[model samples]
Target chain A: MPTVTLSLGKDSYDVHVMNGALDRLGDLVHRSRLTGHAAIVTDTTVVRHYGERARLALEEAGYTTSLHVVDAGEQSKSLATVETLASELVKAGVDRSGFIVALGGGVVGDLAGFTASIHYRGIPFVQVPTTIMAQVDSSVGGKTAVNIPAGKNLVGSFHQPRLVVVDPLTLTTLPARVIREGMAEMVKHAAIRDAAMLYDIRALAEETELGFTLSTIERLPDLIARNIAIKARVVEEDEKETKDVRAFLNFGHTLGHGIEAAVPYGELLHGEVVSLGMRAALFLSEKYAGLSAHASEDVLSTLKALELPLVLPEGIDPATALEKTLTDKKFQAGMIRFVLLGALGQPTISDDITIDDLKEALALLQRPA
Target chain B: MPTVTLSLGKDSYDVHVMNGALDRLGDLVHRSRLTGHAAIVTDTTVVRHYGERARLALEEAGYTTSLHVVDAGEQSKSLATVETLASELVKAGVDRSGFIVALGGGVVGDLAGFTASIHYRGIPFVQVPTTIMAQVDSSVGGKTAVNIPAGKNLVGSFHQPRLVVVDPLTLTTLPARVIREGMAEMVKHAAIRDAAMLYDIRALAEETELGFTLSTIERLPDLIARNIAIKARVVEEDEKETKDVRAFLNFGHTLGHGIEAAVPYGELLHGEVVSLGMRAALFLSEKYAGLSAHASEDVLSTLKALELPLVLPEGIDPATALEKTLTDKKFQAGMIRFVLLGALGQPTISDDITIDDLKEALALLQRPA
Candidate 1:
């Protein structure tokens, strides 16, 4: 697959989506002019699979490498984990000139990227995303964060990565559920920015087992790059998420995050909750934004084809989800700025999303239509 | 007495230096176009003195306000304080559009600024620095951090404040020792960028008791602004401190921070150690940078006039101080980027200064002369 460049002027970087890019991680970092120590932050599970391969690749490229692993779960995304990682980085002699290699899924990317953002008031980092969620979405933008008891991603920074290497080959090792989680975001990208990509996604889902079959891995790079490109374009327009255009990316996140918070984290994967959120949003978009039912169904059909969840998991009260939205970062100055679609590929940010509208949409999720 | 505008394009803001700016805090924030809740993060000591004045002023301007106070001291400048303060801001219903008011000395400013930077992934903050050390130095730069056990300012960000309010009247309530601590940075500014300001500083010390006498309060606004402008200009030139020019501000800080770490914090004030460090820097300047003896003495005489310490406190081993420099942030990538003076106003950042040179500078601190 071709490399997609995120045009952030001086902070601009390239996102390389290819079959074997991970093997060239050191070459990529060297090309970006990143020198000094390279601390690879990953997870125990990911380390067992590809850690030694990544270390050898960096060492072969004439870079000193150190592997720092954490427990493989959302529980590791905390201040304590970040503190421990930072101390380990310092112990490894990582300094202002040193850079971090976030070599795992979204959890590793967010944890390590955030660690790099605050260590010595921030240093450059490279993202070697090993999961579909990271390769397509989290890795492209610089929204690094960790969860606190108060909330998820409550503590974070907009520290962009210096380079991103996405190797689709890693997908073969992921669980089927993880692949579906990333597919949910891919469907979101197609729904909001690239309408035609929905057809491609439908075709890809039919051809491969969640886009991870060895025969399908050959096609995974282009599919992942297209999704990443959509994320990059959105980030380039609003690097800090200050502009409302960035809200389009959060079409499902407002309710998705709320419902995700309603459960013990990890009970439902992030993509599963987002899938449910997208379904609710489609219902609201048709009613509140005059979105054509045809466009809405097109998105829902693609989500269904990918086997993404459309119904909320059992035991999650709609009222609890609604209540959680109140404390969400989306609530700006006591106003809910909801993103809706007037048409496929055309998003509108509306403040007209009343609590009644949300309740009605969430109720629609229970019917499983 | 005038406002100093830090020109950083869109991030530019005004630093108001006036006799009673605290009373007009509401008008200033209102003028800046910041709306929503104002969470004033302060210390226990400061809240007792002027917290009500600040709260009432914002309230009178039709803004909702909350007071969040922590214990007063360097100990409060920790990640724990930042976390507790963050939780308080969240409980106060502070959201994305909400702002933070850092209302105290360096500890308060650093802790609050860092808290604001990470809350909701970054929020605007106003620096209401009440100490000369804060008003003339820390408050002007966007350098915010919370110390970890590994090191000081080990975890932080470059999140600049949207506005800064420096009321010289607040200085009158400060102890003479606190007032002298700020003089160390002021002397640093004059020694680096404005040689003539040294004379003004000496004259100011002569007029009132260390520039905090009620009669001398009127003279403080301009003095503080001048020092802040120097800091502001340097920051504009190197917003991230990546450029060599910003290193000039570290003229005495390298050795100063080393010696400060040599003692249990608060035993010798930051400025007292800096005063000693400045003397040692002068000795190095004469030896390594062709600085004239007369030029060095002229600045030394001004520090003496302010009654800032010229001798290292007994019991602080020079070897320990030198050892501490190895871990100081100034030791960039294994080289000491030492700042020295060729003349009173001519400063240079040099990597040529060896560990032996640091030993010599530390030795100079052992002598009272």
Candidate 2:
């Protein structure tokens, strides 16, 4: 087991990575001292798959449990869904002393954690993330939010979970496309902070099957642990994202958020949009940020091999996407800031890009053979 | 001038008590390093009184200022009001870097602060509290919240203000009832933690016209400063109310909340209900928690002399009020916890009171001569 501790003073919690951390969740909850009735907020699909196991674990650990499942999709990550879940918790009389467990993908985790943050001004919650995207990124950080009509994560709170149980075994059941999508975020993490991890990810992408077998899962644990640690370290230093150190984590997110906003939410996964965004950021990095040309090519090749989208979707206007970038939370004083790759293992924020510059870069990426 | 520092690690801020802190708000905003556009969130009544002064101060501070005034009342503390203010801020293109100034009583402060917390996932806000309720208590603690139909402060965050600029001069125009209502919170602060402050408040209450005079106004700075310090120390040590240490601050709030919920919200000021609630809690503390009879009597005498309503309103059934107690956020598991005064300077949380016991205590406070 590889353990990562998010040392956020008194709010610190541990992220445990192992093969069957799900079954050991009762022990984790016990150790965290969260008692009373445990409410598990998940989705219908997740409940069908691993809900019984999760409930059994909590029951065995001497907790009275209840399950509340929403429809599984990106639509569930909305204010309406959060209000419904909070209302259910209130009707069921989940008080300050009760424990709320968010046991699903990023959508469920975000909505459930946000509900926990606002319910009774906040209560304790744990994360049992089953999706690879969640295990690698969203579950480790304390950023919980719901999508608004204006944008994704427009309303939310920075409420950390009491414990995060990342079981590699859960990902064995994920679809190939989902696995490919999850790899995009891991790849972005590597390209921005760790070149060696990027190399390892590239090597993994060359394999016939993306999901690792039992023997190869050892390599998988360290990579996931390392990426999560980088994020945790950044969050520890700047939990509120006020400083530049934490902003580096947004290396691909500037364009990624725009792409995600442009595309119908459920049509493409977050990591897929992010993968394509990384390519655009790399192009801008080379053109405007003075990044090495070879390193940008390496990032492109690695993403291509993983079957992740490096090009913008068909019929979407680059100008429309660029317009969306202006409203981004990171944009300040009429300047749209971009986190561009300085090298394979480094990134920098740049504000010197013009609309013409972005159009030229988009043409380079979308050029016909 | 008296200044008290509320230290919560990185969220630390100063509560500046002076005669003209309102006029000097620009200097304070500059010193606090707040840049970008300033959106001042106040109510129509406060705007009619001091809004121009606040806007001028922000404008002089080199900020592009916008004023948003909502209808003034406790009803304005709803989610709809919060959304309205949030919409205006967004329409004005307020970004994460922009600063929000909450420039009214608890209603405006709570609504504005809650909106700021949810806006862009969190932004910095400063509190320029004009009311006595805001100056002494609400503005000092980082407990920013908006009321939901289910409960007060149901949706909120512990988002600390960058600075709290309290001008005692602002109180010169306040209604006598409003001042009395504000003093209830100040007296509660003293009753729970500081006997010396409680004695000082008792001395003031015994004076003619309840001590509202120029000399008394001169003494306002120290009184407000001391009350803020008491709250700051408690909130600093326990930012999130995980322990009994922070619960002490809710000394009169348990029953006060029940009263607020039971009565029409705007019918009685929060302090009036709190005064009645404190008397009920004192009665329960003496009978159930073994609180010293002499100490409880002294406390009751001081509250009575202040002309605070120690008696519950007519036609209110103790049993019905006890029912509201169960829904309080402070209640955990099957127990409804009450913050009781063990003595003038000592407060403790008690869970021993049954519905019948609470009913009996309520009856004691409600019985007419």
Candidate 3:
């Protein structure tokens, strides 16, 4: 099987990026010596799709796998969910020596990983991401969390998984819009780390826009693998996001999180808001970091071709967005720590984005011609 | 100020065992470069005692502090309390970069540390242990937890603190019975790691039994400091309890925890049960570990002189105690992994104990003649 290894010293693990990595999930877990009864956490929607396959894979590989299914959406990412899941883990006899498998999208991965981090002071967990959003972005990083009434992921831990099984074949099951959502992150990866990779990603997005075929299947795994490589590299260098090096990956996230908070939960997908946020960030990048208009539009058009929004969703209030940005944990010590592109491949951590700058970022959210 | 530096590599920290270290709480935080506000987590009873002094110390040292008080008992050590305290932390505006101060006994430290470990994926926490139980045992190691209905410390993490301020003066405020409870751990440390320290501990126990005076004050701090060093050494060698060297620290905890479980909550203090558990373990030690009766009696006499129980509670059932021990997380792989004393200063990890051995241990829990 194909894999990308993240070198985080003791916390290091491999991301198996393939067309059907989930089929080999049990072997991967057993190889890591994480063999025992498995308490698998997923969502209702994911259970219907790939749940039986995940259970059988582990069972065939010599594990007593127990499945705990939660609701499908982000609203299900709550402390209440974690509490109930912890009970299920205990009842299922998943000891500290056993492993937990997160078998779904971002919500499942986040809830399962966060639960694993605190259960019996944390046991090992394996990520079997069945969504493009989870495979490309959330699965690789050790950022597991659940939402509280006050905010999203206000409570969590950086509990790294023993292994991550990423199968791009899962993408065929996702909605077309959801596939585009995952593409936004791939564009962000190119914007911050490698400008050359942007060309390959844009071509892939164009193909997805038209339709899937034999070519899409052949190319999708490679696209997911490259995205995982970029993410794995960043996470290796800065595991905790302590310094600016890792913060660069937050290129479109400051405004993205702001726009996400401005609207009601589930109104706009994470990648859609991020796509629009990147447009605003690029506009600021031109003014603050001397990034060229050509490079900026090049990034924006790929998002557009994927049918992602280049502006904030209709009925979103700019003032509310600014207020939510202020409350963001990223806004440390009365400063908005924004990540902007310096050039095609140079990402800058900027603290100079004032209220006026935020207003300007909001202004750039107007629909493009 | 006196300090015992635990050399745990990345998880290394200093355990400051002194009289007036609480006054330097801010200096310690500042020295660690943990600048900014601190959220002080404590119990309602402790808030009335040292809360103002603690708040004032940080305030005078140019740090903002928010105090969160929970109900003062084992009952408060629940996920519900954690949920409420988490909300309080968010309300207090504590962010990732900010710090948390656990200021009270074991319950406060465990609750606050567990909260910090998961709050925003964990923030740096400072432990200001006000009880002897906290200073010598719970606060020294990074073993943070809260009780579930299932068991004590069934849900938790291995989150080490930024600094541990173990002010010995706090023992002065504790009830004489509480002070005796702390001595139980000191005896366990001596039983496993130092036979010579046992003599000193026995002498100290006699003094506490007789009366308290200036001699106690002058000598108690030094005794507490030595206990801290012994604990620090064990934790340094084994941070996560992955090896049996750390398992040595659980010498009497198997039966102790079982005894605690058999009794109603709040019936027997932790150290009291541990004292009784040590007696039962000593009986098992002689059989399975080849320990001499002389060493057994010597340890038993010290506990007896200190007024700790050599027998189980009057109405306790041996079968129930054995059943509770079976449910312990430590009873892994269908074996009762118990730590028994082989000799003075030599503890043995014995997994060969059968049901018959357990019955023998229960039979030995009779009051000394």
Q: Answer with 1 or 2, whichever has the higher TM-score.
A: 1
What TM-score does prediction 1 earn?
A: 0.97
Give me candidate 2's interface root-mean-square deviation.
2.1
Alpha-carbon TM-score of each model against the true structure: 0.97, 0.91, 0.97
Better of 1 and 3 by DockQ: 1
Give the number of colliding residue pairs in candidate 2.
0
Docking quality category of candidate 2 according to DockQ thresholds: acceptable
lDDT of 3 by residue, B1-369 (tens): 567888877777887766777887777778777887799999988888889888888888899999899999988888788778888888788888688999999999999999888888888899999987888888988989887655678779999998998777777778888888878888898898887877887777778765676687777777888888888888888888888888888888898888889998888899998998888888889988999999988888878777877777789988898888888888775677889887988887887888888888887785552
**The 10-residue segment with the lowest total lDDT in model 3 chain A:** A360-369
* TM-score for candidate 3, residues paired by index: 0.97
Ordered list by DockQ, greatest first: 1, 3, 2
Worst 10 contiguous positions by lDDT, candidate 3 chain B? B360-369
Writing each residue's lDDT as its tens digit, candidate 2 over B1-369 gives 799998888888988999888989988999999988899999989998889999998888788889999998878886667656766787787878797999999998988888788787788899989888999899877788776656677667778899999998888778877877888998888788887776777776665255467778788889889999999989987888877899898888887878767776566788988888888888888876678888777777777767788877776666666678768877777777788877777788887777887777777767741
lDDT of 3 by residue, A1-369 (tens): 567999988888988878877787888788877867898899988898899998998998999989999989987788787777887777788778777999998989999998888888888899999878899899888998887777888888898998999888887888888888878888899898878877887777778776677798888777788888989888888898887888888888888898899998778899988887898889899999999999998888777778888877679998999888888878876778888898987899988888899888897786562
Error of 2 at B121 (Å): 3.5
- The residue pairs in collision within model 1 are none
Each prediction's RMSD over C-alphas, in Å, is 1.7, 3.1, 1.7
